[model samples]
Each structure stands twice: as C-alpha cells, then as structure tokens.
Target: MESSVPALPSVLLKDGELKDVEAKPVIIGGMVLDIHATPSVPANPRTTTPGKVHYILGGVARNVAECMSKLGAKPYMISVVGLDMAGNLLLEHWKSAGLSLDVAAESGIPVWFEPVSVVKSKRVVSVVKHITFASPNEDELIAMANALSCGEVFSPIQKDNKKNKCSTESLFQMLRPAIWVLLEEGIKVVVVTLGSDGVLLCSNGAPGFMKGSSKGSNPHGSGNQLYRLVNSSCPPNRFFSASKFEGGSNLFAAHFPALPASVVRLTGAGDCLVGGALACICAGLNVMQSLAVGIAAAKAAVEVDTNVPTEYSLAKITDDAKSIYFATKMMFCQSML
Candidate 1:
C-alpha cells in the first residue's frame, strides 16, 4: 500500500505520490501507550529521578516503526490506542514521521500509562506499561503463554501477575492473537522481545533465540542494543561496520536476554533495539549475520549512559562470536572423533 506521507530517502516508494500507493511499506502491528518516569544514568552513579505518571504512546509496533523511519525505511504501524490525549500524541508522532498509521485500531479504553525507572550504574530502566488495563480471560492467557514459550519455561514477574486477572498462561494467550496478526501480514522478519530472556527471531520459516544471558537489571538501552547487534552481525562486513542502521544500535540491543542480566537504564530500550534490528534486516542482511549485528549493537548500547554519539562494528562481533562458536565446536568434534 502507498504511504500517506513521504518516507525517508531509503524507502522504496511506489509511484511519486505518498499514501495509498503500491509501496511495500514494512508493517509493524502492536500496542501503543504512554510513559512517565524518574530515571538516572548508570555511568553517573546518581539516584533515581522522580515525576508524576502520565500517558504517552509506546509499544513494540511504534518503537520499531520509529526506528525504521529514522533508518530510511518506509514503515507503517498497526496498533491499539485510545482517543485520549496520549493517543493523540501517538498519532502525532507517526504523522510527523510521515509514517502510515491509518491501519491502527482505536481501543477507546483509557490510554495505557507506565512509570519509568532508571539507574545509572546498572544502566537500567523499568517501565510498567499496562498497569491498570483490562486483561483477557484465563484460558486465552494460557494458550498464548504456551505458544509463545514454545513449551519452554517463561515465568512472569510478580508485579505483572498482580496487574492481571488470571494465571500467567492466560496473559500469554491474550497476547498471542495480536502477535499472530502481525505474522499473518507479509512480514519478512518477525521479532518477539522476551523481556530478560533475549529475543525470538522468525524469518524464512525458521525461528530461534539469540539467547544472550539475562542481565538482571531493569529495562534500559535494550532496543538500541538489539539494533546495533543485528546491524553489525550482518554478512560480508560480519563484525562491526557502519551501514544505514548504526545510529540507535544500543537501544536495539537492550531487548536481548542480555539486558535483564547485564544492566539496565531506560524504559524504551527494548523498543529501540527491536526497531534497530528490523532496520538492519530490512536493509537486506541474512538472519545469523543480522543477529550478530544485533548483539554488537546491544553491547555498544549497554556501555553508555544515555543516547549519544556511538560507533559500531558488526563484522568484528560476528567474527568473534563465530571464532568462539567454532573453537567450542572443534573441541567437541575432537572429543567425539
């Protein structure tokens, strides 16, 4: 479909007109909400910042869409938002980016609000999104968790449990349909951000985990972290090299399993990481390479305090990871032989 507004220079716009054209805009369908918080930088070693909570649009769809837009990709978002002030801002952000948001559904519910928390030393931040929102029934939640976990263990935190009406299983079920819908669309790449466990990436009919160890800290530069990792790991260049998707690498990587265990910083890092990875893949790299890039992106993100000027090298990260993986493989092979 054609975008209503002009995409960045990298987008493949169909025809000369924006909107309602035959352009193959990348579609990210998900939820949007608002965030309020008091956060501090990990490097500065400061105490928490404080504030009254307010609503703002946030969610994976918006995060990825925004990142892709910045990276010169034509992205359209599909999400659930209410017609409240927060929702209005959500629409505004998309329109300003010249993104296509007409496909988004209005929930009419009170806008989802989150309070963000940040710690400087840990480079961590936590955001409570969907804090008083309605939840789906128990059966649905169970189904979702099952599908999402791929039968592995997925323990939701206690804080999340208090907000929901049913077992953790039920919550996953409720979330699955929305995720499934995005898959139904012709998305070449699908990324599922698994909070602290890392990411579940689906592309070309295969799926697997990036499986970085959890960083036990709050959410922070995760999204940017993921972006850098995926971008750097991309092929030919392999470890760390600059391409179109370098600016937000750290935020992208923040979503990897590495975040919960490594360190924490801000609320939106997961979104940023997801967006960055999407941008890298959209730029045409293979899956493993994309993942390597994502890891590097995240590593870079975790090292800094706030978003700032940064550098990335995907080839270097990939080469290092491969060398490690191969050495381990060789030892195992030698033992077997």
Candidate 2:
C-alpha cells in the first residue's frame, strides 16, 4: 500500500454489460506451481509416508489476485507464467475467472509488498521507503529493519526459554524498535502476523486509518452483489475514535485474535490473509473491515487444502469478520522514540 495498490473502483456486470469505469487494478508478482504432499499418517522424516500429492496454482501475488477475484475484483496480474503445462494451468484458471492477463508497464497504482524471506526481504528497501502498507513476519521484520537502519540492528527472539516465551506484550516491545524503523522509513502500516495469536497492526499515525472512514473503494452505480455486501459490513463498531484521544499523538497499534478453526494445513494462511485484505481494500472497505475480511478468508483457507478457498460465502465472511473487527482493540498508542 505504498501509494494505493487497492481502492479498486467497483466494476459490475449489469444486464450482461460491463460497467463503465477505469482499467482493472494490476498485481505484479509470481505465478508458481505449488506441489503439496501430505502424509496420511505421522511418520519419521527420513521416510516418505503414504499421502496425497496435488498440483495447484500458487504464488504470493497469484494467491492474492485469485483471492481478490473470488471476492469480486478483476485484477490484471503481472507475473511470469510461461507456455508450459504448469503455466497454462495457471493462465487458464485466471482466464476462466474473467481476470485480465494484460500487463501495463506502469499504472502508478498503490503497491502492497510482502516479504518473501529474511534475506530477499531486504531487496525491497526502496519499496519499503515508499510503501503505504506491509505485512512482515518476525525474521523478515528484523531484516527489513536492519536494511532500513543501514546496519545489523536486530536479532531473533529465542523462544525456548520457559520464563521468556516472548508473549505478545514482550514481542511487541522487542519488535517495537524494528516497527519504529519501518514506520519511520515511510511505511504507513506494518501488520505483524503472529501464528494463532493473531496480528499486530502498527502505524505511524496515518490519516483516515484511525478515524471516520478509510475505505478505499469508489462504487459506480449499484456495484456487484459481493462488493455491496462487502461495503455494508465494514467500519467496525469501534472504528470511530473517541474524542478523548488526541489525534496523531502517538504510534498506533491494534491486536486482532485469530478465529477458531478446524485445522488442515497452514501453508497458505498468511498468503490468503494478505489476499483477503487486499481484496477488501480494493472493494472499498476500510482497513479494519478489510483485515477482518482477510482473516475470515484465511479461516477458509485453513479449512481447505487450497491456498485460497474455492469460493467465499459473503454472509459467512461478513459474520465472522464483524466479530473480529468489533473485538479488535488498540493495545498500544503512546509517543515512543
């Protein structure tokens, strides 16, 4: 979200005709073939256990675009999926969805970047310096912080100690330096994803984020059924800030709990989470609503083997997202140097 990779204008199909609007939002990243091998029973790592293997279309960017498409936005993907069997599968599925394969050289759309790893995550320092939003895990967070700081400034937290298991509060404190670095580097929002514990959304007091409405979508006419449903469920109960709190007085951070789910595989939870949020942002929901919707999408991902749920239930997403959005609270908001 460095500038605005979202705010996808509502493009609806009415009476078998395409709605008048701007070009489709563009997504730049990878189109990879994901091979998943699951064992039927617990066994030693040295031996392969009897399990099922399936080939699926996956890539961080691809997953996000697919998720956005499922949520009702036709995003033009910019990535490398060549004329091979795997590439054809990826393209065919996207083509089937009515998503555009067209790639524009530069559209100036807002960009949202996800760290691929601890090392390569540093490759996008320039991107970070101008990024409006980022979601980095623990190691990647520290790495980006180091690159931003122009030095080795952080170390991994040791979780083996029973007395110092790095609880949420402590984790926040430890990563606060890193978060501070990212925020200072012009990154507007830094969402730290903690497995099971949920997410930490930190910001350098970005405008409209903690206020009235930060929705990114601009609807044209009636909009689609799904996008309309999406807009209705946003602006969480507590999205409005009380007058008592001084504006832009402190760094902002909030915690959202992970929804309870029947476990399957966690391989795609984080990817789907980003996908869901990006989709909502494009659909015109504010950050809180979008994140909630994203989490709901992730819940769906964990329930199924696919990186993204084959189909999303707007009703179910709204219901589950409302709970998360309402329950979320600003856990930290104080001036910190």
Candidate 3:
C-alpha cells in the first residue's frame, strides 16, 4: 500500500468551516508491551540478580505518537492489540490520554515513515518515493537500502570495526551511497541516528520547505528560537560546504553532536528523537530546527527507564535544541570523502 498511515497538519478545516481548524497527528503501527528490567547489582554468571522490572507501552509509531502528545499534540493512533491483559492496559492508557482510534483524515500534511523492523522494512520500498521523512537506524537503513537498490548497497564490514565506528564524518562517508539511494528515490529528508555519537540529517536541499506550517509553543517563544540562531539557507559556507551532484542538484547535510547524557536504558532513544522532531515539525519548524528538538528528546529518553519520558520540559528541550542547532557543523552540502 502506498499509504495507510495519514500525515500530520497543524490546522484541520472542519464541517466545511474555514474558521474551524484543529491540529491532529495521525499515527499508524503497533502498540507493544515493553518489559524493562534493570539489575540492582552486578551478578555472578550462574545466579539471578535482584533487579527491577516494569512494563511500558512501546512501538516505533506508538512511541512517536505518545511523545508528540507529551509535547502537546492530539495524535490519533491506529494499531492492533488483543483483548488480553496487555492489550487492555494499552487501550486504557489511550483512553485516558484521549489518543484516538477513529478520526477523519485531512489533506496536505508532512508524511513520516518508520521501518518497524528489518523484516518489514523492505515491504515499504514501493511507498518510499512518497514520504516526507524516514528515520532509520543503522541496521534498518542497510536493510532498506539494499531493498531499494535491488541488491546490496553497503559493503560488508568487520564486527569490530562496526562497533567502534563513531565519527559522524566517517559514518556518513561509508553510508553515503545507501543514503543517496533513498534521496534519489524521493524521500525528502533522511535522519540517521548514531547512538551516543549524535544524529546526521540529509536533505535534498529543502530542509526549509515546511517552514510555513503553523506549529509550536506560543509563536513568540522557544518554539521558533532554534532556527533563528543559525541560517538554514545559503550556499553552504562555514556551517557546511556545498556538494553538488552530477545532475547539479544540491544536497544539504549536517552533523549534530549528541548531548551529554546520564545513560540508562537505550531502547527508546531513536524513537523519541523521531517523535520530538515530528512534534516540532507539526508545529511548523523547519527540518533543521525540528531535528535539534529530536536530539533533545532522545537525551530525555535515555535518562529514564521507559521508552518515552512521562513528560518533557519545554524549557530544557528548547535550551538543549538551541545548543545543538547552533553547533551543528554540517557536512550536508558535500561528500565527506
């Protein structure tokens, strides 16, 4: 299917009234029961360690939906769950939060795609060219790249080399071909997460295309502060160098360093990053500005035991985002190699 998941828009014209507008985020995917366990102390190989375990709701799409809600967006989610205990718990939370299972659709909103798993990743190749954004971790990016290219896109790497790889420049260089495959296929922006190292954002030179969307905190506040700190337009000067393709198309890319975080569970970091960016994007920030918020959100996820934080501090989110946004030295306009 080209699209079963609906996109997001800030204003929904309702009941044929142009004056009646609502901001609704449409989310589609699974809502899983996430079990978290942390040992209180180091244990011997043959014995069990005293630990804490908790169940949390998790799914790439679901996490993104919930994170957006925390950031103040009414996101209507679509997913399946059983009538069993886990399913009931999941449903109860949705009901309590007022996340919708049924809602009418809208037109002309940004579309974001998530590769739920490596196995299910290839299934979306047919719909790739239509999406506005795709957030894929290393493995999923490889899987989708191979599928999109109709063959292997990344050369095999040694196990040790893969583990020690952290430099954004080096990583982007190795993954350029694979990343380009997606860009040429028509996905507008690619946000690749590098655990602990930071995030790399690549666009077909249109990061500001969504600039006019009405989104964010009281328009006069931090919601629009990050983008104002650094320029998103210009022929890639000090912030980044310009790289032009053979066809003369310009690509804008940037490497945003990860924030210093007190690490905990790493499971939901990437998912929350996507969620944060989506929230800001829906609020009308450009991709560059939205990504800073995404990184800030990931930092919050790591400090907690759950996949998504119970709540996010707008003050902290904005502060951290500004730092990353201003400091991002883009490799966006050129090939690192």
Candidate 4:
C-alpha cells in the first residue's frame, strides 16, 4: 500500500451569497493555536497592571490560514488541537471563515493556554508565558521517533532564553509528510515562513529562500520608531548589505533578502506575508511576483499595533512590492550557480 494520505475531495461552497462569485484558489494547511496574554503598558518609570487581558487564536499556520480566508482564498488547516474550548473556538472560527478543516487532528490533550507579560515598551509590553501544544498521539510519537533516526527530522538549535527559541519541531514533523502529500496532489506552491530568515518555497525539490529586508520596527510603536531612525540615518544603499544570493526559479524560490526592515513584533507578520503571497499567486502572478506580494504583506503587518488589524488594508502591501520589484527582477535574472 502507498504511504500517502488521500486528499479530501473538494467541497463546493453553495451558500447563497457566495455561490456565484468566483472562488479564490489556495489551500493553506498547518497548525492553529490560541494566544492568551496581558500586555504591559509601560509608563514613565516601570510598572505592571492587573486589570484586563486579551486572548486570540494565533499560530503561524492559523495566522496565515485566516489571513488567506480573509483575502478570499480557500485555506485548509491540518493539525492537532485538544478536545477543549480552545479547540472548539478554533474549529468554529474556521467554519465561519469558509475555510476547509477536513484534516484537523483533534488530540485528547488539555486545551487551556497561559498568559505572559513583557516589560519592554516595544510591541505589546507583555508576552505569553507559553503556547499550549496538543500531546501527540501514539502514532505521531512513533512516526516522529522513526523520522528522527533517518535524519528526516531535526530541531532548531537552542538560542538562549528567548521565547522564539523554543522547539517547534513537533509541529514541523506533522507538517512535512502532509505537505509532501499536498505536493503530489498537484499543489505546486508550498511556502514555509521562517521568522527572520524569510520564506521557503518547495516544488519538485527545488527550494529557495526569500531574504528579509531586516528593516522593520516592533509591531507596536517605540521600537518601530527607533528602527526608522536607524534606517534613515544610515547610508541609503547599505541597508541590504547582509543579503547575498542568486535567484531565477523554474518552480520554487525565496525572497526574504528583499526585506530590509527591522523585525519587531514577530507575531502575525509571517502569516500575513504568506497570505499576501498566496493571494498574489491566486491572482496569477509567478514566483518573483509572489515574493513581492508576500514581503509587502509582511511590511503591512509590522506597521500595525494590534496583532490582527481590523482595518487590514493592502495598499502598503502593494507599495512595499513596488519598492522591491526591480531588485527582485535583477535577482531572478542572475543564475544560482
């Protein structure tokens, strides 16, 4: 028997309002989780508040999937969530958004989340204590252990006490095989957004990187201001000195180097960027064009204070693309030797 998971047959959305409209083409599959936390509102000195709190569904996969749905694309999420309220909330949202949730893995683990607080006056002065993960089932654990022995599984190196340094390898292990199945099923475009490095596109094993601008502010205000000052004061053309690469893709490629912004809030930007890129692809753009769209979308995301802006506009996304379009064109023209 083949070791491949069968693709779910396409379900037509026949709801009265959307029946006639042309459906956007795209399927984003991955994990989704809730983020519950209280942000520190830094004052003149330094203090903490104990009043209101905020909670939202936020995972890299969730963020991108929701963003794509909002942009009129069909995003299908596949990952584990426990049999708890958090899981229920996630499924409810996905259903409401008109996204496909055919392959979701409902784990038998706890679903509650913990809150965190950041003292810095950057994005949201506070942070989440940690993210909640669904305990892997027996099959998942066996599969992960098996893949590890074969060198098909690897974990991110520990980078100190930073929250971002924690292991996401568990999620990746689940995603890899599912995505390979997606590839075999004619989904040629597959994107994995690595926070600071940029995005990774895989098709027919020809993977590439999209370099980030490294020029961004924190998702909030103060740090964002600081990044702007640094960029303005520095010599104009020296912003992207860190980028060195060649492009020109037959199928898969990356373009993070095109971004020269300082990363601040590193929260929903990756999702927004992926959504933007996918949207561009749905709009009939190629790899270079999609990178421009994705980067611009990330720029739009970082320029906001809240995680998901209510007024999430795409104009800045367009402007950001225009700013780097020529540079990407040049990179694509160069051979990757």
Top TM-score: which candidate number? 2
Count of residue pairs whose backbone atoms collide, per candidate: 90, 8, 4, 29
TM-score of 1: 0.39
lDDT of 2 at 311: 89
Model 2 poorest 10 in a row by lDDT: 10-19
lDDT string for model 4 (138-250, tens) is: 23322332332344353333243665553333333334453343234333334444454344444433322121122332231212332232223322233133224323232
TM-scores of all candidate predictions against the true structure: 0.39, 0.81, 0.77, 0.45
> Candidate 1: where are CA atoms >4 Å away?
1-23, 37-56, 96-234, 237-266, 296-337
| Whole-model alpha-carbon lDDT for candidate 1 | 0.34
What would you estimate as the lDDT of candidate 3?
Answer: 0.65
The window of 10 residues in a row where model 3 has the poorest summed lDDT is 12-21
- Candidate 3, position 88, lDDT: 93
Q: Write the per-residue lDDT of candidate 3 for residues 183-262, one digit (tens) a residue.
A: 87888778787777688788766344423333322242322443332223211123322222222266666788898999
Model 4 quality (TM-score): 0.45
Strongest candidate by lDDT: 2
Candidate 3 Cα misplacement greater than 4 A, ranges: 1-22, 38-52, 96-108, 156-166, 208-248, 332-337
Colliding pairs, model 3: 215-283, 216-283, 243-333, 253-332
Supply the TM-score for candidate 2.
0.81
